[model samples]
Target: MANAVPVADFLVLPPRLDRTAEMLAESARRRGMAVEHLSSPVVPARLQHSAGGHLYGGPTFAAAVAPDLDLVPLEPADDWLPQLPYEYTHRDIALTTLGEARWSRTPMFVKPPRDKTLPAGVYVDGSRLPGDERYPADTPVLVSEIVTFLVEYRLFVLDGMVHAASRYAVNGRLDPAPLDACAHRAAVLDFAAGLLDACADSLPSAVVVDVGLASNADRGDEHWAVVEANMAWFSTSYAANPDQVLDVVLRAAGPRHRLTLRDQAFTRPPTPFPGTGRSGSSPMS
Candidate 1:
């Protein structure tokens, strides 16, 4: 009989590995996949020539190596959150250019929708946004009303299901807990199901969605709201099952040729200059 093919030829990590990356590497090894931690941002010629595999890293690192490795990194659409129903978002969200956003003088939560080039926070006003000199005036950003999250949970979703979940924060502080032990596990899953049913087309089959219990100051009530959707490969698993997280990561960033038609729209466009590499300074989380 012929030897069976491995799920992936390699599970690639960025040069500066983190505990999450190390943990994922161990998980990959246990699944009979070879792991490669690049020495730098540059993709080795050998890896570029070999059968492609999946990459696990942040946007910066993925941008640097994805073209050379032919990996397809999946991400949520820029307007996804803004288009979500108010029940799911619980806050006013808008997609606008940094140039236009600079005109706002009121407090608002602003962030670059697709990348971390701009610091995401509740800015006192538009003047606090990074100068147009640093980022292009036309850089896309998400502007939303500020809402405090009492707790935040990360759900690793596959095929519109919450495959694994972990509570990552409480009252804006890091506090990782497995979903099994979480008091709101049922509510979280239920909320996620409603969200997927409403707008699964807005996301890739494999992705991470963060939901939180938002405190509505005026209403004096707390309700579930989606914090945001993030690339599964770039998200921190926290206390989520490594195996389940890996399942999503593999599909989120894998050989480009294997990409499904539905996911084609979600794939990060290939870098124009595939050979130009940048430092892998970004964290996996």
Candidate 2:
């Protein structure tokens, strides 16, 4: 009930029906929620309407819309640095090259810093790690310290509030094992909320905080670390519980706002700097 916001869908698929915002919105409607669809004429030609708040969409969406809507991104804009080799963030940090992470905790799980786009992987310092089915080295890969965990958990925060959470285990040991769900929940919420608050002004409408079991000094205790930050849009919802995620998005993605190209919305203006627009400036956001 705290996330009582109204939302509309901005379809990025062209009049061609190439995307799923309509279908997804319909599903929400059946659950007694309200969603609106915008007409192209009112929006800027270069602009698009996307669900999950474009947190995972192409940088173009952010570039075009940021100037019009006061949206801040939890992650970096696309085209910053290569994704962090692992699934963690220092918040609002930028990586200009792979060399920044030259010294890293080996056996890391490299993942991309930005979400929604492709050509990313979780790699080790130089080993041929598995999970390549989802991440091939063909594209730029994120090299991170490999973290094996009792389980991986995700927390979805909406408007500075803790809304929903889910935990996953490649192994089912934690299903009923003696693990403290509330503590992990608390850790994820505390860290993510602080990070979000740090960049609260630019926080997107919806985003997911992924928490991993990092090393702890408790000897045999399972340690938790913030592995990867992801957008709520295309996250597999595997480790995440379905109903809870859906509910949070439905509530957070609200009150459709139409901003004209001429309107000034986003406060943090990007510097055109002559040649930056030709390609995405940085890939990390």
Candidate 3:
């Protein structure tokens, strides 16, 4: 009998290995996959590239090596949140340019939909947003009504199912717990299923969705609402099952040739060349 080939031939990591990256690499190695930690943003000449290679790093690192490795990084559509039903979002969400958003006199939550170029938080008003000189006036942003989340959960979804989940935060603080150990596991999965049933088409097959128990300040009511969608390749596991997280990460940022027809639309456009952009700037590992 011959040795079986690994599902993913290679798993690439950034120069600095965080706990989450270390966890995924260990999981990948146990499954017979090779792990590569780049010494710098540049791919070394000695390293061989393969179509079966998958990357696990920030968007900047992905963009840096994409041209050479032929990696297809999957992310949610820019308008994914804005298009969702009000029942899920529980707030007014709009996709607009920074120029237009800067004119608003009222406070709101503003963030760059896919990238972390602009900070994600509640701004006092449009005037408090990053200056136009730092980000182009035309830079796209998601502006929404501010709501306080009492608890937050991160779900790693594959093929419209929650493969792994963790309670990442509570009361705006770090509080990691595995889904199986969570008291609200049933409610979390139930809410996730409903959202996926209605809006799975808006996201990639392998992605992360953050849902939270949000409090309405005026009404004093609490309900489940979507926090946001994130790329599995860039999201932190934070006590999620490492094996399951690896499963999604492999598919979310794997070989271009292995991408299914449904995921092709969600793939990030190829970077034409390396060393053409910034690096080391992801909110999550």
lDDT for residue 237 in candidate 3, whole number 0-100: 95
lDDT of each: 0.84, 0.42, 0.85
Candidate 3 C-alpha lDDT tens digits along 20-111: 99999999999998898998767654443455778888877777775567568888988999999999989899999999999999999998
* Candidate numbers, best TM-score first, in rank order: 3, 1, 2
lDDT of 2 by residue, 9-73 (tens): 33222122213344555555566644433332123333323222322233444343433222333
Ranking by lDDT: 3, 1, 2
Minimal lDDT window, size 10, model 3: 276-285
Pairing residues by index, what is the TM-score of model 3? 0.91
RMSD of 3: 4.4
User: For candidate 2, what is the TM-score?
Assistant: 0.48
Better of 1 and 2 by lDDT: 1
